[model samples]
Target: MLSREIINLQVGQAGNQVGESFWQDVLAEHGLDQAGIYHGTDPVQLQRVGVYFAEVNHAGSQSKYVPRSLQIDLEAGVCDRVRSGPMGGLFSPETYLHGESGAGNNWAKGFYTEGAELIDPILEVVRKQAEACDVLQGFQVIHSIGGGTGSGLGCLLLTKMREEFPDRMLATFSILPSPKVSETVVEPYNAMLSVHQLVETSDLTICIDNEALYDISIRALKVNSPNFKDLNGLISKVMCGVSTSLRFPGQLNGDLRKLGMNLIPFPRLHFLMPSYAPISDPKTQSYQGTSVPELVQALFDRRNLLVACDPRNGRYLTAATIFRGNVASREAEVAVRELQTRNSNQFVEWIPDNVSVTLVSVPPVGQKQAAVALSNSTSIQELFLRTHETFAAMYKRRAFLHWYTGEGMDVMEFSEAESNSQDLIAEYQQYQEARAGDEDEYDEEEAPSEGFSQ
Candidate 1:
């Protein structure tokens, strides 16, 4: 069996403190085995994974400006391991504005401190680590594409890695910002463009949306914490969940090569809204808006099996609202119908038009509940299957869209070819039987026990 490895790189201000805390909490909570830290300059040996940390140089910095740093930590060590890594490598925008524009860097500091300088160093560190790893001959590398440092420098690093180690499986977990945040529109798009540039070079790219998580968090817990302390914790939990689902012995599927698959997993929130009915009691009938209890109940009702299974993946049902407005219901119904049509094959879109509803999807890296839930087997497995089906359906749907729009060759041709490639009918039948047997056993175990009459 091929062993899996994780190489973590720290970039920008977020990576310095908040990001680190989140990752540590996640690892500890999940009881993941820790590997040695991949100090950027060290040679990679040993049959283990490494977590590396580096600081990116934002434009504003003294002479000793470092763009980003990479570290590799095994699954066993305490959270304190992150502190031993380098600090102060990030390049803020202030440094560049003073150097090139010849203005008081502080004035343009916050606006221009894009951390562009760290791009090269980040790439260098990644390349060096890849070269040092003897065991990395067939290993895959997964990283993120979001945040100031990770999204910017990380993308460049991915490009460099692709050129240096063409054979390695390079996958990225790209984070999409929440719509409520100003950066949501441009940052994710930039990250996507970076991914697109290296798409053909890498094995696969997985996209995660921060907006979804934020919405869910606010709606479900009635709290909106954006600090790295909170956000990173959520993301770490999510990463741990995905890693566990693929690596845990009980969760593995014989037919799937977990190590070979280049997956980008993210969190999504689904919400449900029920139509409100007037109270029969003459005193309470005056209420026209949704009740708090009703909204809470709706959120719980729409919780996906996947979130319970893999909290780390950030797949959960957050909140639900009941709206009595006709306009709101009609608009929601239309949107839900469109989404259902789009994802008809794999997911059942359950949103109704006449209900006031909003679903939020958040990255689980910083979520507390999700982090705690990662160790549970039942929860992880359910999430694993749900995510698999969701992605598969998405891929198929996108292909169909491409084919229909004349952007690519007819997918039907490929489907027909796959159908005739082997005895799919027989294989499918066998698969169904096996699935049925497994379900039967599960049902038998879950069935109410027979006992003396109560």
Candidate 2:
């Protein structure tokens, strides 16, 4: 197979922070230093580096690898920080784009006013990046859904990308808001509007929430007072895990579209829950030893989920489990099969053999073995429901109507967004109630209660 390329777009403060950690990990894995210079002697490290990097050669200097990524924000503060950070030189200067005045946490300001003004310039930069790829597979956007820049401007860029490169795959590492760690009162409004746009724009949306991140850090990593950096580190691990097959030689190598095809059973139902295995504090690594089966089980545990939802509430439509390290393919396959057989009732019978596994020979930088799973489970509706309730509560009183309407946005867009979000929630509920071999005859009253057949 030809080496495929992926362009990453990081938006807003949260997105750029996660992107920073992501690039740091990616560089370490590919043996590239802080300055993007190759320092390791392993030739295999550079084999599939083109997936996220562009190899540049100067007239008389050795080769340097630059990330094919863009850092965008509605304010200049975040972008400026990244430019002066430790790995600042790793990126091309032109990739950073920002505006003078911040969006002030207003979705309309970012989407209709300030964000719209910068769309054409952002697209031009993206176009140049795409042109440089040998075989561009798709783009991955990293953003949050609870703020102005990430929620509003991020979706704007996604809309334009879909229009400009209709055929390429579009995936996102979307950060959803949680009341536990919210920075603004209108996060529900911002989040719902972003989801409405994501339903139409993105091919795959990997849902994440701060509540879950806090739980994992506190419980697993033993972080007493977890901060954004702690949360971003966990997200960066999953981000790298999801792209492992594309970044390295793997037994079951699948590109962005192929991976999406396997996991996404329906078009609008592309939101997924991600879980990572062998999650432990580095301080306790010496006492921990995990097997393939244990790791797979960990991947399904609700505590390990990056999104705050219980898989037990809804059946699994499909899943892709990517294992990294020296684990044998035969053992990994057996483990997944046994897991499916043991917990057959947890999965949907409509899609037989719904679980797929991939084995990458190289493990993460510090771990002996690791695993990541992306589950298209109906339980994720719980997340949307939470956002809907908050949005409805706030909309009922028209608490922050003036800020949005002042930016030339009509009140109908809010109604449409709310209605669209409700519809999305209903769609998930519809599929959750569906049973195998009974598409048309799915009578809710007669649904099985004991357990679904294998």
Candidate 3:
């Protein structure tokens, strides 16, 4: 299978330098102290992956501009290398940032601009590597979905890659800017739209907020420098956390095709939280609904909220609903119940067996994240009882459904149909021979390969 990681750096902007520092910090966090050493080393095989740097032309005031030096660090030692075939030519689209008109003029500007021609060479290299593999695999593309270059261009590139390599799995790690530093109205909306587009095409999309990461750095590490180095280090650590968790040897490889066999396409739901705050009590607790808002804020404070979603799926959530058990305070329980009832009346509709609901309860950090799935159940007790066996039990139900109804099932059914069709044709030939009184039976020879395999 093809396994690759493609990181798009915002070369011309301050974020580009920040990204470098992020990478360094991540390496340091993982205990890899050598400078530039992390780029060449494979996380799985622990070898050097060839790193290549390319020059991309960023947009200026005029239509044509001088190219800036942006680098793509590829770990070639990894199993799946980017191919050099038809798929490689897919990233040949220009990246442009769109801005709001009139009042938002100051808030809008091009982050990075590049003609389609500039991406051609990079894609060509990817195509060549992909074509040589027997089974095209998984890819992790990292870049910020903020400002111009990373958001606009990165989304376009992801869309093209998805179109070209439909069979292979792809995931994107997007960095979001802090609301305070953002241009407020326009930039946030632009970034959100860009990310939405990328998520629709990708298998899984992971988001890291710059504000959250920065807070962690300042509070936890006491890093005072606001320069690119420190900022980049924080971003890199977040990326590394995700990359390490998903691709670590013991962890299930985060290939969507493989994941599809055991889990539903992660539902697409937008998680809206008020904002970040300082944590007064570092101690963790199982708070009820009355305190859920504070708990969520605290979770955000720790920068530990991990949200995964598939935008292509039709699962839209308009409001938040919290559920608490006996561990929660009485006030918290009452508050949660009231909120759920209110939300149920306003936003939720009770569909029959068609819809599945998942309730994941994250325990105090030292414990595991508890998850329960409910279908057509009125009380939480029934849902919890059904899902109480183990973490795998909760996923198993979803996995079975995904395998039977999702694309995974479709692919298998299609293959079976082709096999049956071939069998029918062969039988028809045999029947015709019998009718014509022919004694010999037909025998088929192995087909020759033209470098491509079915």
Best by TM-score: 2
Q: Note the clash tally of each candidate.
A: 71, 0, 28
Error of 1 at 283 (Å): 35
Q: Model 2, range 224-312, lDDT digits (tens) per residue?
A: 99988999999999999999999998787889998998899889999999999989998999788989989988998999999999999
lDDT of 3 by residue, 289-348 (tens): 324444322422224322211111111122122221222334333433443343332212
Candidate achieving higher TM-score, 2 or 3: 2
Models 1 onward score TM values of: 0.41, 0.96, 0.43
Considering every candidate listed, which one attains the maximal lDDT? 2
lDDT of each: 0.32, 0.91, 0.34
Each prediction's RMSD to truth: 17.6, 2.9, 21.1
lDDT of 3: 0.34
Residue 448 error, candidate 1, Å: 29
TM-score quality measure for candidate 2: 0.96
